[model samples]
Target chain A: MKLKKNLALSETGFVFDPSNGNSFATNPIGLSIVKMLKEGKDIELIKKNILNEYLTDANTLEKDIYDFINMLKKLQLNENETSND
Target chain B: MKRKKITVAVTGLNAIDSPGPGVPVIRALKDSTYFDVRIIGLAYESMEPGIYMHDLVSKTYQIPLPSAGKASLLTRLKYIHAQEKIDVIIPNFDAELFNFITLADKLKKEFNIHTFMPSQAQFDERHKANLPEFGKKHGIKIPFSKMVFNVGEIPALKKEFSYPLVVKGKFYDASVAYTPEQAATYFNKIAAKWGLPIIIQEFVIGEELNVTAIGDGMGNTIGAVPMRKQYITDKGKAWSGISIDDEHLMKMTEQLFTSTKWKGGLELEIIKNAKGDYYLIEINPRFPAWVYLAVGCGQNHPEALVKMALGEKVKPYTKYDIGKMFIRYSFDMIVELKEFEKIATMGEL
Candidate 1:
């Protein structure tokens, strides 16, 4: 499903969710992933874009992306789409 | 003349590398209209002049710094086990805060005491690494930082953020760092030394400000005072300060208390960036030092806090006659230079 749903944003890139009342900080790329996730972008598309921009190798990039995505899940921002898989 | 009221003071070392909440608070409660003040110290001879607290206080209980681990702290904790006719147990340091949660109920049974401490969950949230998580969730900006557990976590971190990052403990430890490497080195040393977690934060240079306030258990505010750091010791302690009033800063306290339903005194620190953005640094769930400076300027935050806790209707704090400052310069040295030479061998290898 979607973990990046219903995030809050301020002009200075401050994002919070008043419901859970939690704050998160994102770098430019990380914000892009969150925004894309909010916009319903697929994880595969997000990973490809991150690889093209960052100098990291495929495996390192993939691992970090997965780790970050898992962290989002742990924070309950990620939505599980078990049916889609 | 009326007899003096009984008050209580809690303290730890007031030095650089001590981002503590005790010493200044002790000085504040001493001058209040509350109970005759008695100070319980983890550091000896804190404060200067007719102000060593031993002299100012009606009673004094001095405790040595606890050695690392459970046995040492438990040993020192025994000295204070059943002592003092204490009404309020003020934890001026984080270590004390953690200890008091367990000891609060224990002390209450022994001496009818009440302490203002955050829950275990709240305290875990206030720690350094957890800060980014907290900030990320609450729209707070802590200097962008990373967390480290052991010495091996050092090299994995590279200097991409900026120069002069801060290295601090997860919960109740001093922050130290100038560069990422310095931070890494510090983390490794402390990990080996103390066997705890640490974090590296990007340093944002700005003026440090804190709002100290009391919140009724209900969704209402009682009293709050805003302050600025005047001087910091070599160990990251706020040695001196002054009082100021800002409506926006005061509202943050209101909003935070209303949001968290926080039930005691809390101190919120923020750094005003050059562009005038107030980045949230951290929240300490206790009274701040230089709280007396609030009184000297006609606020008396500690007294207001006491009143609220005692269930008296508290007069809301509003007007502050600015330009009040607390300077921590050389007060008289307690021991002489020759005496320093003599005691230099006390804890030596």
Candidate 2:
């Protein structure tokens, strides 16, 4: 799933959605995943990147990534929802 | 350019659990770039916190409440104006607006005290009881509502409305009732405080949004800022909110001014459902307690209102910073007993 094109990700992990002016703060891992999504990386690539950089196992990483993506969808930060308008 | 000095009087200084707009309005005026203001706090109660906040209010004078009639209010204002040489008066209480609006012309003509306010006709049409007709006339979407004066009318409401409707007072207080019994209970409870014609409104589930805007009285919208409550207190007041970039909301606000030529500061309580439809919930005819959020967003509505009250021409603010948030916190100030005694006994401090 793609992130909203206009979502502004700051160096401090502050996420600002310009379309609706909603803001969110994420941890380092969540920030990295968001950055990866912004770069149009697929879910498998994101999962692999996180696994290589951290101590988590493949199964846990995959589940966490999917959960994070679902959160993005729930907050309406996905490109699909923005484009639907 | 040098700023002009002006003496201004403001009321509703009760900054408590459910805070009034006075303190924030004063904060905005103090931040004004156009004028240097000497704030005179007009209060109905001696315990109003703004009276004791010496840094914000230059002098505090106890005034009669709105129930004391306009004549008594005008007489007290005359006395205060005599001492303060007041240039403008801003009444911030919803309950006191009628007395202030009635005295607006007399205040200007007699004491040279300027006030920027909506006309009686404009004010009357936007009341809670008149909102449905107002929506129809202006082509704005509002939830269906009916006014009931007695408990006898509550049973008939089931025919026109469903369960989980809203029961509201004329001026303040609202409750969502899931059954007719709850509706009757809320009606009596609210009516006891605010008095009759309890309004029964259709409950439309949605994400609530609000817009604080200023109109120039000539169909020009000077500034508008839309916000969403990030956190709310138990009393339903916004503890924190963030400014949003909603083009549709801004357009709707501008269209409202264009159609009504509404003067002064107004807040539009709105509900936007999942289908993206906006329903006008209520219209508060003055600056809200959270108006400082608009100032933080770079619109500075109170500053604009002051300029308008002084007859200065103000251009519309075309842009404001979005994603700006305001987190409200309460503070306790320690005051000596002498200061309290002074206001309580002499009515001035």
Candidate 3:
């Protein structure tokens, strides 16, 4: 899934949606994931990168990434797309 | 350019649970780039926190309450104007606005003291009891509501409205009644406090949003800033809120001013339902307690109001920084009894 264009992600994990002026604060991993999504990174690539950099089982990481992507969709951070595959 | 020095008198110094717009209005005037303001605090109660905010207010004077009638109010204002050479007076309380609006011309003619306020007709038409007709006249959407003078009308309300509706007082207080008995209970409680003609409104379930704005009396909106409450207190006050970029809210504000030519400062209490329809909940006649949020968002409404009061041309502001947030907090000042005694007895501090 692709993140909305021009979502300002500050270094301190502050996410600002300029379109509606909604602001959110996320943890380091969420920030990185948002950054990666903004860069058009696919879900599998994001999952693989997190897996290589962090210590977590493939099953748990996959579940967490899908959960995070679902949350992004709920928050309207992701553009209209059905494929999280 | 040299800044002009002007003395301004303001009321509603109480900054408690339900705050008055006075302190924030003063703060905005202090931040004005065009005028050097000398703040004269007009208060009804000595314990009003703004009276003791020596850094913000130059001096404080006790004024008679609104129930004392316009003659007493005008007489007190005349005395204060003579002593301070007040350039403008901003009355911030809802109960006192009628007196201020009625006295605006006399205050201007007698002492050359200016006040930017809505006209009497404009003020009368926007009251809670008259809101439905106002919305109809302005082509704005308002929830269905009916005013009842007694609890006997509660039983009949079920025919017109469903349970879990809202029972509101004439001036203040509101509660959701899930049953006819509960509606009667709230009806008596609110009526005992604010008096008769209680309003029962259809409960519009949605996010509550507010727009604080200023109109130039000539049908031009000087500034408008919409915000959503992030945290609300039990008293229904916004403890923390953030500015939002909502074009529809802004358009509604402009249309309101363009239609009514509403002068002075006003706060529009709006509810946007899940279906994306906005219902105008209430129209407050003066600046709200969170007016500083508008200033924070770069509109500086009170500053523009002061300029307009002085007959200066103020162009409508086109932009403001979004995502600015305001968190309200309370502070205790260690003041000696002598300070309170001076204001209570001597009537000036």
Candidate 4:
């Protein structure tokens, strides 16, 4: 998806993706998702990696992960589910 | 129409006494003429508040956080607090929202609360593969993508999708391998944990757009705004954003919302490629914090949500300033640089 380049973030996990001009106050987990997508990781991969890196459950993590992915995609930081993944 | 006190359930890890989104939204609804407002939170940690709750709270209660293994009455006591009259549960996170949706029917019947949530099937529409499913049905242009289950499938995926292809997991999976080797390395380390496949999406170089809206479960739109990201910080929150009012984008979003019959809050993401054609990307089924930025222009959504949930009629949002901006001027500038370097070094920054 088309992402706005005007991003402003803080150490405390505050983020503003300038492409859409939508600002967000994200948790550390949410921050990780943004970083991964920005690094070209697919939404699925980002969710997978985050769960592995953090000490959390699989199911709950998945839902939150899915929610965040939806957030990123809807924010236009990433496109919709076009992956054959 | 059921005439009952409107309830908004806000789930938290524990009863940490602090003024967060829940307090403000609850307080706003408390003043509404439509329904009585009560605050609810999930207890994950100890039961103590760092700060005292406001006097406006009519009643405050803590329901133990529900877990997959433990589904006890205490876990669901918050719903019962309304005593079959609780109307809404606004999950602040994925797990909570999933919980609310899973119990939507039961809550409606037992509590007489009209919960507007995406169905279990509808939840898939918001997954990583969500856009593809939506677009495939309606011909919404999206980038090429590849989803893989096993690491051995990497080479096969590459041949079909290409190098810049993004490796993806299910909805929230983020483990990646830019190359077949990286993908395999990650898979080898994490495969046992996930039962689902991962994906690799074609890296499309383009601009990003963010849209936020509140709907009444019908085609008519309530509070809404289209934003162009202006300033972004290192932590990934929109440090600053400017609201954009575009008809073409709004029209496209309207059609999708109507088709989905989406209720509650909604956000649509679209991007324009070099061809200048906008491709459909994703939809968020909740209130985006960034939408709060629109309040200055007369779009106060958190307030609108309170009004709507209270059974108050809201006028459609049709006009707003386009250049309004929000930004985090100073972040860990070094961290920002690192991120910029990561993207730029790869020619993506």
Candidate 5:
């Protein structure tokens, strides 16, 4: 999944969407994945990177990543995947 | 000239849509020319923005919520005091005021933590449940009101209060209802959140004015500034306001202070009806979110309060700049995850 092009992400984990003037915050792990997504990393690559750095198992990381992506979609921070994808 | 350094602890740092006054009060204290302050922020949640604003707050410790009662609050405060040697604590939330007020004397005696607040009698008299009697006793005009425990009593309110009546919760929230059914609906809504003893009152229609003032524990008003809200949010908080020159409002404020022997900071919500009469709507026992506006007008009430708490003799402020306007703005502050993790895990940052 890709993040909205207009989203402003800060190193401090503060996310601001100028489109709606709404701001949000996330944990360290969430921030890492969002940064990877913004840099055009796919879900498989993002999961592999998190497993390499963090102690969690791959299955748990997979579930958490899905949940985090769902939350981002709910917050409208992720752009809908188009037919080109 | 060097300024004396003093450490002060303040609560109510949640500067959300409807804000708590703690942040503005701290801003004023930091600007004081008389003393340099080291601020200790006491927060209930890890995500309270004031806790993350490192420049505004020296350090923040997460404290137990007021619902946990006075004992839990004191235990947590004692721990903070052991480390910080907090000199004064300014509580800015109404829900937590009771516990702080209960422990005020003990705090002063045991730890030398000073708090300038209204006496228990003064606080009780100004509650929404007792405003009618308080108005009569103090000779102040207030809207006729009655307290009801259950929604069943709402249907009978028609004989006393007319249409477009205000249904209010004990601590917060209010809805204007045009009929008994609507009143009952709001009654249940408010009662579910703030609990029983819901207040039903005659809805006064007029221009709303607010006065933020501080009393010197004696029968004197230390400082008072009146303002008219120019823009209000949907939650009924003042978003932008302008200071006004009103003699009648000043006189009423002095009367309330003198009659009640009020101490510390308070906000007087007043309604001026069609007949030119002023009705006191509510008396919030602590500083309102717009307190910095008073400091902007040269009153510097929080500074005066700190002086009084330190046992300094302070004279009443007699002048203020009129027509000064304040518009509230919100900005995003980038916060590091490590800082958030620290507060969340260790409960202090």
Candidate 6:
């Protein structure tokens, strides 16, 4: 799963797809995950960082992260939606 | 003489395919010779192009949608008023007018925010459902209209309305139906979006004429400009329009003001038939999306509205150059996500 290179993600969680002119606003953690994904961070690494920083257990964090990624895909923010790795 | 500086807050900044009157209203305010204005844009969405148009809107704060109800709206406005000290507020959206009207008196007493608008009674009378009665009461000819709650009611509409009638929502959206089946389908569509009581009206076939006018609280008109839409968008909004000289249209506008004792900005949507009679189709209590045409024609309705809100004596505008035209165009600006972020997260930018 990869973040779209065409998507402009701001520090404060505003996402704009210049290609389609669609804009979206996400929460703080969502912003962090998008930034990490843009940097080509692996799911395990992103999961580890979020679990350590946020007040959540491993299972819940995993679930939440996956849910958010699914949402990104649904919103067409993912570059390669079917990428398994 | 130095221009007196005052802060003004305006809503309805969405300048899109279905545009709002905010940007052009701000432009009119900016052109004011008397007041050097600081514009505070009240936006409902972060991406409303007006929020990012820094040259026109000095700053923007996202307010809760009217569907969220009035208290939340007031709280947000209170926060904005504390920061901006807004002297006047011009609300442009039809959906949000009720909330603003409800807050009008309190805004004046508590924060001294002045708004010039029609009374609650006048506002209610002009609603799409109520327009037939409103036209009747004011001695204006209106196309026969009936309110329907269910698809079953659509079949019965053939008695009063002919084929190719208009199906309208309570607040927005309208579709022309040439058959009962089409009317039922459009009923479901409009009712799904805007909710119950879809309005069915006799579709008057004629040239559409519009007049943007402002009325003093008393039975006096402060400004009136008549125009014919040259081009219309798919959403039924005027894409290009021209000011025209029409005595009957102007007289009808005067009669409406006299009868309603309307206050603030109003746009009369009229359809003139082959028999040369005008029918009142709709009355938008706020300025129409094509309000800038009024400015282009030299009426400057929004500016005059501000003057009235501030309690200045404004004489009725008697003359406007006929045949002035306005053609709207869209521009794509490279807005940084940071600006969008501030408005989304912090609710202000």
Give the count of colliding residue pairs in each prediction: 24, 0, 0, 75, 0, 0
DockQ of each: 0.01, 0.42, 0.27, 0.08, 0.01, 0.01
TM-score of each prediction: 0.64, 0.93, 0.91, 0.61, 0.80, 0.80
Off by over 4 Å in 5: A1-85
Query: After best superposition, candidate 6 residue B319: deviation in angstroms?
Result: 0.1
lDDT of 5 by residue, B173-235 (tens): 988999899998999899999888999888999779999999988889999999888789999
Candidate 3 Cα RMSD after full superposition onto the native fold (Å)? 3.3
Q: After superposition, how far is residue B49 of candidate 1 from its true place, in Å?
A: 10
The Cα RMSD across the true interface for model 1 is: 18.6
What proportion of true contacts does candidate 2 retain? 0.44
Which of the CAPRI classes, incorrect, acceptable, medium or high, describes model 3? acceptable
Best by TM-score: 2
What tens digits encode model 4's per-residue C-alpha lDDT throughout B286-317? 65546555565566655566566546687877
- Candidate 5's displacement at residue A85, Å, is 74
For model 4, how does the per-residue alpha-carbon lDDT over A1-85 read when each residue is reduced to its tens digit? 3233335567688875433445578887777776666666775677679778999888888788777667777655544332211
For residues B1-349, write the lDDT of model 6, one tens digit per residue. Answer: 7998999999989999999989999999898888899999999998899999899889999999999999999999899988999999999988899999999999999999999998899899999999989988999999999899889888888788789999999988989999999999999999998899899999999778888999998999899988888788888888887776677788889999999999999889898875567899888889988888887877889989998999999988989877677899999999898988899999899
Candidate 3 lDDT tens digits, B55-123:
999999999988899999988888888789999888888889898988988988988999899999999
Predicted candidate 1 versus true structure: per-residue lDDT over B1-349, tens digit per residue: 4635554545553533343446556666666665456665444332322223345434434444433544454455555535545566566665556655655566556556555556666677766667778777665556777776666666556645555566666554445565556766677666665557676677777667777777765656666767777677765656776565455566666776666666666778887665445677677767765556666776666655555545567756656655466676545446555434422333110
Q: Which candidate tops DockQ?
A: 2
Estimate candidate 2's RMSD in Å. Answer: 2.3
DockQ category of candidate 4: incorrect
As for TM-score, the candidate ahead, 1 or 5, is 5
Task: List ranges where model 3 is wrong by over 4 Å.
Answer: A1-6, A18-22, A39-62, A76-85
Per-candidate Cα lDDT values, in order, are 0.60, 0.90, 0.90, 0.56, 0.90, 0.88
lDDT of 5 by residue, A7-83 (tens): 77888998765433356898888899999998989999999999999999998998999999998887767766311
Question: What CA RMSD would candidate 4 show?
Answer: 19.2
